[model samples]
Target: MKKRFARFKSGWSLNRIFHDVTGALFAPLLISLPVWADAQPIQTLTIMEYRAHLNSDQPTVRGMIKFADLVSEGSNGRLAVTVSGATVPGSPEDQIKALQEGGPHAPDMMLLVTPALRHVEPEFEIMDLPFVVHSDRQAHELLDGPVGRELMSRLESHGLVGLAWWENGFRQITTSGKSFIHATDLTDRPVRVIPEPAFVETFKALGATVVSLPYPQLYQALKSGRAEAQDNFASQILVGHLYDVQSTMTVTNHSYSAIAVVANSAVWRRLSVRDRNVLQHAAIEAGRYERDLIREQAKTDSAELAHHGMTVHSLSPTELARMEAMTEPVRQQFFRSYDPKILDLYRHQIGTRWITR
Candidate 1:
């Protein structure tokens, strides 16, 4: 027996024995190993994407499309976005609801006007106050500042994430028969206002019979003589072909119409940190693009309207002051409903002098 054991040990060396034992123990593990173990770990990540829907095909919607393109490029195919205009039918409120609830057809992001947002958060009405924001510069300053940031942050409670403030330019008046040369011109006139309380109150304060209507219905309303006058951005007037039905354009600049780029809160949270940053920066850049487009369009819209047989008029500084004064009660009524701190912040940002009351 000793002679047999010695011969076996000499033939089976320690290294060979250890190797055979390890191979037997690890044979299943080696076979069961994932394919990734033999190759480089997956360098290609799954692409993340989202969809955006805007209320109209205005400059803001174009900007949203630009934003989608930017997010895709900025994220290097890690994130993608697709944008469509006026995909949802009905009022802006309906669009907002679709944004709040997510689905296959519902949008992950939306470009909502400030007035529509007022229905969700009344503090948004501060941005819709007439003549409060004097120029594009003032509007940008206010919306890009602390007051605007606070207002945006407040949207979290409403299941929205305010990304940036785009614009519809300043609201101007268009009438079918008469030109708005003074605040009194709107008095007793049937003027179509957006379906927002502030708009209803502002027009009523100016002594006009306010007809609350959705934007899509305005041109037909005027053409059918159901409504005689309306206020909207010059781009909206040009795009909607309101000049075809309306005979006059008044550069009232009554309120700077701001469009908010908002994402659903749940959707926002689902994004990776890097992707959220990309989306946010893309939104801000696209908003700047939209504002520039609107402003440039404003410079020539009057001439275009004139070419279309619509006489365009501008309100004199004195007349604007008078109009603002006339709307003071409307402002006061809205002010009482706002958070004092937020109102004060807005007032402070716009300069106290601009606040008539």
Candidate 2:
């Protein structure tokens, strides 16, 4: 019996049994690895997407497309974003809702140029006050500087996580019947304004009867004569082909409009920290690209407006000073309505003397 037990514990038999049991325990794990390993790294995720009347040829839309492309590349192909331009089912307000409530079941990111955010945060309209920014550089200084960062940081409470500011260039006035070399030319004439209160008030202050209209309807309004005058960035005026009806382009440079690229808070939280950093970096790079594109296009569109038979008029240095003077009342109104600290920080960063706040 002792001799038989010793043989059972010897090399080949014991080794064979141990190997068989080990294989049995790990067989399922080995077979299951390919299925687990081959799984998609990302199933569904927040993506930056836009659906606006902005033409693909327009700088804003071009910037948006480039932004999406950068994000996709930065994600190493794990992230995908789709950008759709030219009129959507609803107004900018509706798009914001879609992002907020996840109406389509998942809210992605958006590059919005509208002041609809005033509904969520009224202070946003302060940036839209007429003639607040004298040049694109000043706009950048305000946005990329302390003042802009503060405004952006305040957005966290408003359901929007502000990513970057994309320029839409300066808002210029164009009309079908007259050339507005002076603010008085707008007196009593109906001018279309965005559906924002500050815009409506500013135009009214400028002695025009303000007609609030959605952006998509502006070209039709001008053609149908519901409103004979409208204001937008030069690129939009050219892209919307409003020159067909509008006879004059006044380079009033009333308000320098900046679009905010934002993600809904809920959707933002869902991103892994690593992925979030990737998206934020991509957004900053896209913003830099947009700024350069706009500076070039602003010059190009001014020439194009003239080539299209629209008389392009720029505010003279004297007239620009007068226009700058008018902004004080608007800025004062803003401080009274919003917060003085905002305007104070703006003055501190850029110096109060450069801009007559």
Each prediction's TM-score versus the true structure: 0.81, 0.81
| Candidate 1 pairs with clashing backbones | none
lDDT of 1 at 219: 76
Off by over 4 Å in 2: 1-40, 43-51, 86-88, 103-106, 353-357
lDDT of 2 by residue, 52-160 (tens): 3343355555565566567656776555444432222466677677667654544467776638666666767767887767787888888888877887787787677
Error of 2 at 150 (Å): 2.0
All models: lDDT?
A: 0.72, 0.68
Clashing pairs in 2: none
Question: In model 2, what is the error at residue 201, expressed in angstroms?
Answer: 1.7
